[model samples]
Structures are given as C-alpha cells and as structure tokens.
Target: MTGWRAIIPLNLGRERKTRLAGRLSPSERERLVEAMALHVIDQLRSAGSVAEIYVLSPAEPGFPGTQWLKDTRCGLNQELAHVLGGERMLVIHADLPLLDANEVEALLREADKVGAAIAPDRATTGTNALALRDPGAFIPAFGEGSFARHRTLLPDAAIVVRPGLQIDVDKPEDLELALKSGATSIACPI
Candidate 1:
C-alpha cells in the first residue's frame, strides 16, 4: 500500500478575491484568504501526519516550510505529480476553509482502501478534495460538474460526506456562511 501525501492547489494571484462582484475590497478579500490559508496549514501540521504537504503557489514570505511549485506551465495535475512523486495523493483545493485534518485523514484512509475517493463540495459541482492511488486520476478537470465526472470515472471510489469538506468558499455567500459558522482553515504554520 502506498503512503498518503497531501497536495494543496493554491492559485496565488495578487488580485485574488473571494467575494464575487464588489462585495469586499480586493485587499480585504485577499487578506481574508491569507488568514484562512494560514489557519488551515496550522491545523494540518498540528495533526502530526507524516505525509508531506505540497503547496503549489508562488512563495509567500509570510508562509514558510512549504514546497512551492513556481512553474506556471505546470498545470494542476503536473504539479500534483511533481509534489507527490507517484505515491498515493490526497488533493485538496485551497479555498476550503473548513478542511480539517481528521476529515482529510478519513478521505486518505478511504482512498487507500478503495484506490479512489472524492469529497464533493456543497454544490456537488466542484470537487473540493480527491484521493487516488494513481496519478492518472488527477487529470485537469476541476471546474463545475467535476464531481459527477470523477464519480463516473471511478465508480467504486469511496464517497465521504461531511459539511466541512463539502463547503468551499468561492463567492460572497459562501464566505458569509463560512464566517457565520466560524469555519477553520487548512493553512500550514511554518
């Protein structure tokens, strides 16, 4: 059995904004995103998993102890393969503020057993996390309706249903809901 490692796909852009339209200023939204990332990373490191956490983003001096994939040409699948190095991988989106270590570990364990697993977001359109023993499963299909596509590809993959894993902050309504519930982040603290 292959050991489990984590791959966090972070699209670090200067003008990144969580709120759609003009709900929040660009700077304010970026700051909130940073805070959420920090919180999530801290929680994951605290979990004490031997699995490596591969962060694919430009170097953020504020965040350390992460392996950054600076190559822009390396799409999500390539970056994931580069970081994970052919081992079983658990891929999680950076926007999931409520992603806890326990939930992550659960998905990893299930993947280990079933060879594939998926944690669908609230809309069931976007996949927040996916676990696969094979790197081929990490193809670049992360847009809407991806959850169903993944399920179609891997029918026997385990399905983990948890509110924390399902809720991802993509727009203002999502962020507001997460804030109201005091959602935690998956950011690592180095």
Candidate 2:
C-alpha cells in the first residue's frame, strides 16, 4: 500500500452532531466529538501507511501527533477542497467511534488497487471514509445519500466495507451500535 496523509474535519459549532441533541447534552456531545476525533487521529498515527494526520477544525483537538489546520467553516466539501490540492489523501469523518489502525490499513490497501476507495455507511448511503489519489479528483459530498453520490462521481473508485469504518456514530442507535461493536471509552457517558 502507498503512504497517504489522513485529513479529519471537525465542526465543533452548530454544525456538529445536531441529531444527538435528544440523547446527549451539549457538553456531552462536545466531549463525544472530541473523543472520537482523538481516536481517529490515534489510529491514523498507528497505521503503517499513514504518513501524516491533519485535523481541520475551528479549534485544535490537541491530539499528540496531529497537525491542526484552521477550518474555514465554509462547509465540509469546501473546507476539504481548500486543503486538498493535488496530493494523495484520506478523508475520514470524526464520528467513527469504532475506527482503528487495521481498518485504516485495509482502506489504504484497497486504494492501492483502485487509485481511490470509499467505505460507505452500513446503510450504504453515507460515506464514512474516503481515499483518493488526488485530493481534487472529485469533490467530497458527505451528507445524506453521499455514498451513492460519491459513487456516481467517481465511478472507478473501489468500495471498501469494514465494520469499523462503516459505523460512524450520528444518532442514538448509531452510538448503541458502536458500543455493541466494542468501542472503548473515548468520551464520558451520556
């Protein structure tokens, strides 16, 4: 597998996990976000193929080996587009509670075969992890039904399905799924 940089975009403002409001308080939600982001950075650091890890956000998440970039807050796609010019990179969501080094390595391995690869959510509608040969190869569309949208845009990209990469905690059910999937305590309890 080729070496690649990982970019994680975190929106700590109103844009962060609004769907979890019914289950977790504002502070609890923030803690969860930070925890998951840290977990992702840690996993990337441990991954053999990961060269650098970058956290793009309004404020620093302060993980030990990550480079923090100031997020323009313009939107996920635009913010990502600003940082990705022509380098090979992996864009991972911050809410992936079950993410680990193995999953990242698997994704990169698949990318080596297909130039680009994406791990869609369990429902196969949302994109949780995306890898590209060139950052600008395709614009990232990461919201509702984004998996299908991304596939449409990058028809040649391989589809990698790993449980850890597929399970990003967004709703209460998602959190439960992560917990059942052996996700450790990265954040405090709701």
Candidate 3:
C-alpha cells in the first residue's frame, strides 16, 4: 500500500514566541526553534513509511527532500489541501520534535477507518496535530481555543487522543520541560 502522507506547516514567520526567552538570546531562541523543526523532519524521513512529506512556509525551507509549498492567505487550511492530494493527511507542526513515527503511522492506519482525528495539547485547549482522510476537512481556527473550533468543524469525525504526540513548544517553560524530559532531540535538528 502507498500508506498516508504527512504535511508539516512550518510557521517560519519571525513572530513566534520565544520558548527560551530568559535562558537564551533572541538569535539563540530563533536558531533553537529552527533546529527543532529540522529534527522532526529528519525523524519523519527516517521512518520511511509515509508516502510524502511537505513543509508549508512562505519561503522554501533549506532542508533537503522536503516539498516546500508557498503558504496561501488562508494559512494552514490552504496548505493542508495542497499537500493532502486526496489521500489521508496528517497535519502536524514542525515544532514537535519528540513525536513517535510509529504513532504517526498508527494515526495513518487509524485514519483509514475514521474520517478525521486530532491530537490536542496537554491542556486540551489547543490542537497540536490533526489527521483527516479528506484534505478538505481542514478548517483553520488556530488560536487560544482552537480545540473546540476544530471539534465543531468535524462534528462527525472520530477523535484519536494521544498525549506525547500532542506536545508542542510554545512558551519558554515548554522548552525547558522538553529539554529536561530527555526529549531534547525533539528540540534540536534531527
């Protein structure tokens, strides 16, 4: 079988919050974020199970073997459609360095049965990852309370709740937790 495909929307715009604001300088923080993204991409490639891997950004990411698609005005929803290509789509964030490829594979396998599945943050207030059998299922409402918004969008869609896979770096404390938890590889370039 061709299996499913994964698309990582790399929010490379400079406005992201500093995960290590107090511990690292501004330049170091930016570099750290970039490294984390590369690490996740590398792990995905190592799995060699997913059919395709694309990174969505305004500019082409320097990483090799990744399909770089220019982000549209609609943000993630548009990018999800471009990469999904009618097959099952696993929409993940590049900031999640500690993701288990097997978990991703499981999500893909499960997607074969369900219409959609989403991985929410620890707080269960925000969405960290989303999976859909149809690319059109993506409706971006990413913000403080996006978890509810997405659930509303896919009222009939199945939900696959995973904890570790849902951890995404956002605040400075999150970065420290990732590093201290030995999932630091998820913070560095793979």
Top model number, lDDT: 2
Error of 2 at 117 (Å): 0.2
The residue pairs that clash in candidate 1, if any, are 37-187, 40-185, 40-186, 40-187, 41-186, 41-187, 41-188, 42-187, 42-188
The list of candidate 3 runs beyond 4 A from truth reads 13-15, 78-85, 186-190
- The number of clashing residue pairs in model 3 is 3
By lDDT, highest first, what's the ranking?
2, 3, 1
User: Tens-digit lDDT track for model 2 on 1-190?
Assistant: 3469889888755546778889888888888888888788888889999998988888776778888888877888878877876666999998888887999988888877777899999999999999987766367888889999999988889999998899989898999888888888544555
TM-score of 2: 0.92
Query: What TM-score do all the candidates reach, one by one?
Result: 0.83, 0.92, 0.84
- Residue 121 lDDT in candidate 3: 78
lDDT of 3 by residue, 87-173 (tens): 667777777756777767666666667777777777889877777777664556666887888889877655656644666778767
Candidate 1, 1-190: lDDT as tens digits: 5456666677676467544446666666666667766655665565444256667775543465555556464566565545554767777777677767788778777887788889999988878888887755346456668899889878899988877788787787887787676674422210
The number of residue pairs in model 1 that clash at the backbone is: 9
Q: For model 1, what is the C-alpha lDDT against the true structure?
A: 0.69
